[model samples]
Target: MQYGAQRVSDINLSQVRKMFEQASPTAINLALGEPDFDTPKHIIDALKNALDEGYTHYSQNKGEVKLRETIVDKLKKDNNINTTADNVILTVGASEALYSTVNALIDPKDDVLIPDPGFLSYREVVKIAGANPVALKTSAENGFNTTLDDVENTVTENTKAMIINSPANPTGSVMPKDEIKAIAEFADENDIIIISDEIYEKIIYDKKHYSFQAYTDNAVTINGFSKAYAMTGLRVGYLSACSEIIDEVLKVHQYNVACIDTATQIAATEALTGPQQCVSDMTSEFRKRRDLVVDSLYDMGVECIRPDGAFYVFFKQDNPDEFIQKALKEDVVLVNGNAFGEMGEGYIRLSYAQSYENLQTAMERLAKIA
Candidate 1:
């Protein structure tokens, strides 16, 4: 079958994502990486207030002035990086930010370096943008942190960018300051764009999250209110890059969806500037679940990285595909790590986004299978 573009072959992760949506008793999804919390009442109220005030209209393609300013303030206060509002581009969510950036940077033949056990979206986004996705292997033995040695082996002249996620998805590993600095320096020297997805920045267990933007001048910092503020439905995420890169991405943005909703922009501003207690509370709860899962996995003789951040556990099994098949029969569904990329083989990514009771029950079910 002929398609308009080769990239059309790209598919969403819906095959595994739909495991829970289908409501199979044989499926207990710890697959999707979504915040289980309800959107804070105050943030919801802010949207209602915007509706009452007739804030509905086509917003600026780059987003509203106030929201951009709020995002700028957030970057300075939280990440300790000074960024101007003009350098930021608001997209539907981090997903769109990632797509837009990859599209803007790559030609049909370009290659993008990605972490092995990364967010499932990275490769799909790269392929959809008409680029080749190259997996740079990072292992559980190495704490799933990307080393300069691993990346140096992967980079070539055709490499256009590198996608980095810390407080990373699936693995839940947070790269330290020294490693981030080394990667940033490498990107700078190689003239490759670094797309840092910091969406899970706030869900850390013990250590503070580090933004790659803090270490380099050549990286794009991708963030959103979805994970941190429990505003997943709002679909408001923004990217902070150099003005040159931001301009090119906005060109792609204007052609494909035009812009985000005005009311969501207003609500997002309130999320950044208003009370932050919700984020703190959510992080505390996630930590508790992380502890429970980590302890349980250890007891089961399943080796997992001691995740410093994020609500996930990337645990190894003797044979991941076989174990996942058996686990589904045991009525505790999880994503086979190989679904993310080839380097993700022999692993299973279990999201701790469910309640403690559900996690405990799921663990017990897996134990029975063991």
Candidate 2:
């Protein structure tokens, strides 16, 4: 009579969203990964026009063809991925893409290597697929960089895949090209499938994103419109790999949502091909916020590492739980880094998604605890 699947019981909501829900009404949230910007008017306009033009119906089961084509072109131009529209499957968001692809590729008891202090969704999805989630430990001492040695030690006959996030959530550490090459080389030698999550690719500061797809035919590149285009609510994201792999993922994607909303697909097409200045403007502002928060951490004398990309700052705490409690008292919402993984125990993740003014106020409150 007990109906809930054991996997559903194990997977909790993301700590970022949980913390936001728990915060006092007056709290300035520096926890969630959501960008605090409104979706650009052009994208919204495209959606409205799409609706007026009669795009309210369901699209192809794999997704809207035009949107998938745009994704193919974007992948070719921006990420150096050479793939056709047939290989791209649009999904609800990167969240859905990740879940579906993991399900498609992993068998029960297979080990999927994930970075400790990586994105919140990686482990849970692997668990949902009935795989053993293995952690690849990364440290602030090395810029939180994932190296070949760390990956090598973790690989084994049971290793089936690895979920890599550049401009990672929580930590905001961008994996470097050399490190990526090493990973690519290793995965090739061992036949490990690499799932590259490049959701934060466009928000990086002064660094070009190098996709693992560029280095391996076996890699799956997952990205979305939410982070870069400020279209989070639209729920547009896609997964790209070889046609063979995409064929399998499409089975799962098709049955789940069947298809993305037609108008949203049109909006996503506009996001990829439209004027790109908005993305530049947003990332420029994020760079400023990144600098502002990192500088504030230094000013407060907290031991912190400057996150290279994305909009988070990672600060070490001897007791992250106690530190989080203290920060809550200051009315500054913060997430214990342990929410990321066990290796994240001594740290806390502070996202800079708020405005310069709000971040300044949050910093002022956090400084009281410092």
Candidate 3:
């Protein structure tokens, strides 16, 4: 059969979702990267109240006006990013926000730099956008932190953008502010756009998150309510960039998904402005889980950096694929590390989004492995 676009073929499937789908009734799941906590009750009530208030019409392509305004207010207050409503675009999720940004910026034959062992979706999205996905290697040796030198070596004349994640998925490693500043400066010097995915900004355990746009003007900051407010089902996220880039991405979004669900937008607005106590509470619990998981892994001779933020623990195993398989057989479903990228061969990602009881049970099972 004559195939679909070659770029379509290049998009690999997501290992995290696949592993999550196969989590048996008897399995202890640490494969998903969402909070186990319930969505803050007020946020849920806001959505219901919106529905009751006849908010069923299609919102503006960007999002509900109030939500966009809320994003502007929250960005300025939380991250020191002075984005206006014109500079923000809301999408179904951060995944869609990422897709829109990638599709908007990348051109045929251009190159995009993504961290090796980074978000599994980055490489595929770059390929599908018809850009070469260049992997910059990071390692457990340095707590999975990518250095400026590592980023510099990967840059080329054809390089159009770089995607960065703090409190990074799989590893939960927050990029240091100095490193983030250096990268922002480097991107500014090269006239490259930086795609900063800060979805876990509110879930940080040990350190504060510094926005890339705080250090430089050349960045698109992506964040969502899913990770922070346990609103994964709401499917609401947003991107903030300079107005010029926002205008460009808005076009791509208009052609794809015209707008996010109206109720979700209202709910997300409440999530940003309502009681932030839920965010603080869940993150504190995650910090406790981080300690428990890291301590357990160390006791089992599995070396890993204690993540200063986020709820994941990426650790080395004897043979990651084999270890994951065995763990599944033992009713502990963990994502295989290589699923993230080539540099993740001996590593496995453990999410502490599950209950402490579940995480402790999984850790005990892992420790008993021969």
lDDT of 3 by residue, 1-370 (tens): 9577776875778889899888788998889887889999999999999999988988999988888899888888889988788788999899999999999988978999998889988998888888899988888778888779889888988999999888788788888878988998999999999999999998886688889998888999999989899999989999999988998999999999999899878888888888888988988898889999999888887888899887888888878878888888889988888898888888888988899998888888988783
Q: In candidate 2, what are the lDDT values of residues 273-318, reduced to their tens digit?
A: 8999999999999999989998988998888888778889989878
* Model 2, TM vs. native: 0.98
In Å, residue 150's CA in model 2 sits off its true spot by 1.1
Relative to the true structure, candidate 3 reaches a TM of 0.97
The lDDT-based order of candidates, best leading, equals 2, 3, 1
lDDT of 1 at 61: 90
Number of residue pairs clashing in candidate 3, backbone atoms closer than 3 angstroms, sequence gap of 3 or more or interchain? 0
| Cα lDDT computed for each candidate against the true fold | 0.85, 0.89, 0.88
Ranking by TM-score: 2, 3, 1
| Pairs in steric clash, model 1 | none
| TM values, all candidates | 0.95, 0.98, 0.97
Worst 10 residues of 2 by lDDT: 7-16
Per-model tally of clashing residue pairs = 0, 0, 0
